[model samples]
Target: MKEVRFFYAPEATITEELPQDEATHAIRVLRLQSGDEIFFMDGKGAFHRAEITLVTNKKCMYRIVETMQQEPTWRGHIHLAIAPTKMMDRVEWMVEKATEIGFDEISFLNCRFSERTKIRTDRIEKIVVSAVKQSHKAWKPIVNEMLDFKNFICQPREGRKFICHCYEEVSKEDFFSLISSVSQEESLHESDDITVLVGPEGDFSIDEVRMALDNGYESVTLGKSRLRTETAGLQAVSMSNLARRI
Candidate 1:
């Protein structure tokens, strides 16, 4: 049996030709020819099955044969906002794994104790696209630009909000348990969104944690063991995903 290949085409339904990078891969790397079957994802909950109609040196055009809308793997939107690690590869790995596990969105946080103040979102976006294809996820997670910790917490947000920290002074609840309790509630809705904040390796400063708490963000813990920045972010996402499963 021939393997099925999926390509990321944000406007797959509107455009007959693949994007430049995807086109290059299909024509040069895959050597796909006319009449070859291919699949495309618009990253917006739909997949298009197509057959290559024309293949040129620079472009690969296809005719859509069928379009299918995919249901989300999990209920609600799970958003993770974290401070990027000094080593970018660690952050990249976390994003890839989280994408596979399933999540709605991710944002970078410039916390008070952030080791790295800046991030290359373009690179991270590429990695996310690759993961979406690899996982066969219908909806691509939205990547937001890095935001100051203060500004991010102050922004108006919907649904449940949480901050994961390790300050002994601040009373906290177990993240998984809190989410699970809510899941059992009769008020629980599938559209309910959850956003969790994860700090850097140095962790959010005491003052920063206080600010988040002041702004309607509940304090939560991801168990007892101390985790690295990337690990904590991935764990937060994993917990959120699991809660939805329950």
Candidate 2:
């Protein structure tokens, strides 16, 4: 038996030819030839099984055999907003892992104590695409540009909102416990979109935490152990995915 491989192609159905990047991988790297069976993900909750009709020097064209609309593994939207670390590789790793874990969206925060204020969302998008393909996820996570902490908190959002900080001054709830309790009360049919905010290495400034609280974001703790920025982001996504698992 042969293993099935999936490729990222946002316009898979609209266009018969694979995107440049995907075409290069299929034709050159994978050495795929005419009449080969392949699968494509449109990154919008659909998967297409196709047969390669033509392969040229730079293009791989295919005809769709079947189209499948997939349901997500987890219910609701799981969004993670975090302050990027000074080292970009850490942030990239978190995005990759989170996408594999099946999150809906990710946003970067420019906090008061943020070590790295600038972010290249294009680079992060590529990482997300690769992860989605590898994980065989039907939906692609949205990668938003970095926003100031103050502005991000002020933005109107739906569902449950939380801010994770290591502040003893503020009363904090255990995130996992809260999520579990909520799940027990409501039926699985009810979907609650959740957004979790995590700060940088130094954590969110007390003032920033207060601002978030003022904007109706709950203060929460991941666990007893202190975690790095990247780890905290991954943990938040993981917990949300598990709680919302269907």
Q: Which candidate has the highest TM-score of all?
A: 1
lDDT (0-100) at residue 53 of candidate 2? 97
lDDT of 1 by residue, 1-246 (tens): 136678999989888999999999998999999999999889999989999999989999999999999977787889999999999999999999999999999999998889999999999999999998888888999999999999999998877899999999999999998877763455455446799999999999999999999999999999998899899999999989988853
Residue 113 displacement (Å), model 1? 0.8
Cα-based lDDT at residue 64, candidate 1: 94
* Cα distance off (Å), candidate 2, residue 98: 0.8
TM-score of each: 0.96, 0.95
Which sections of candidate 2 miss by over 4 Å?
183-191
lDDT score for candidate 1 against the true structure: 0.92
Q: What is the lDDT of residue 18 in candidate 1?
A: 98
lDDT of 2 at 45: 99
How many clashes show up per model?
0, 0
Error of 2 at 50 (Å): 0.4
